[model samples]
Target: MSLKITDECINCDVCEPECPNGAISQGPDIYVIDPNMCTECVGHYDTPQCMEVCPVDCIITGVEESREVLEERYRIISGQKVA
Candidate 1:
């Protein structure tokens, strides 16, 4: 599942730089995570960096997806051909 920034986000500006896939961005009100680019750090790290650094714990999991799907996304984002 892709992570989402909820309204509880304080806009602390920490999560943006922490996202390895550059999926998180400043939205009109709070930070928003691009589902297309979000792999939850599947291929990059053991855990989502943005969620790790978010002080307010506003980042929440989005639509349910299997680990295989997330892994495929990570590979595509990393420019690796799916095997």
Candidate 2:
């Protein structure tokens, strides 16, 4: 699942930089995660870096996606697609 920053977020500005895929961004309010670019850090790290560094634990999983889906996103983002 792609991690999302909830309304509970304190806007601490830590999670944005921690996302390896650059999926997290500062929204009009709190941070937002782009599911299209999110791989849950499956290919880049053992766990989502945003979730790791969030000070308030406001990051939560959303729209549960299988590992296959996450890995496919990683492959495409990394330019590893067979084409």
Candidate 3:
């Protein structure tokens, strides 16, 4: 599933660079993940990179998406259509 940054995010900017898909971006206060670009790192890594580098462990799964959905998202981001 797609990950979401929680309120625990300190706006540390650590997670931003970790996202390979460039899904993570600076929000009004915390980091936000663009669902359209979020693939849970399926195409690039074994695990989510943002969650890996988040100091506060604020990143969590199950944010309005499922694994199948995320996989489709990855395909879309990689210029492939979900079949």
Candidate 4:
């Protein structure tokens, strides 16, 4: 599943730089995670860096997706041939 920044986000600007896939960005009111680019850090790290660094714990899993789906997204995002 992809992660999402909730309204509880304090806009502390901590999560943006932490996203390995460059999925997180500043929205009109809060930080938003691009689901198309979000792979839950599957290809980049053991865990989602943004969630780890968010002080307010506002980052939460959004759309429900399987690990295989996330891995495919990671491959596509990283320019790897998807199997």
Candidate with better TM-score, 1 vs 2? 1
lDDT of 2 by residue, 1-83 (tens): 47778899988989888888899888998889998999999899999898888878998889888988899899999889633
lDDT (10s digit) by residue, model 4, range 1-83: 47888999999999999898899889999999999999989988998899899999999998878889999999999999988
TM-score of 1: 0.95
Number of clashes recorded per candidate: 0, 0, 0, 0
Can you give the TM-score per candidate against the true fold?
Answer: 0.95, 0.93, 0.85, 0.95
Query: Model 2 clash pairs?
Result: none
- Report lDDT (CA) for all predictions: 0.90, 0.88, 0.84, 0.90
lDDT of 4 at 44: 85
RMSD of 2: 1.4
Q: What does candidate 2 score on TM?
A: 0.93
Stretches of candidate 1 off by over 4 Å are none
Candidate 3 accuracy as lDDT: 0.84
Per-residue lDDT of model 1, residues 1-83, tens digit only: 47888899999999999888999899999999999999988988998899899998999998877889999998999999998
- Give lDDT for model 1: 0.90
The pairs that clash in candidate 3 are none
Model 3 per-residue lDDT tens digits across residues 29-64: 888988778888987899888888888899988566
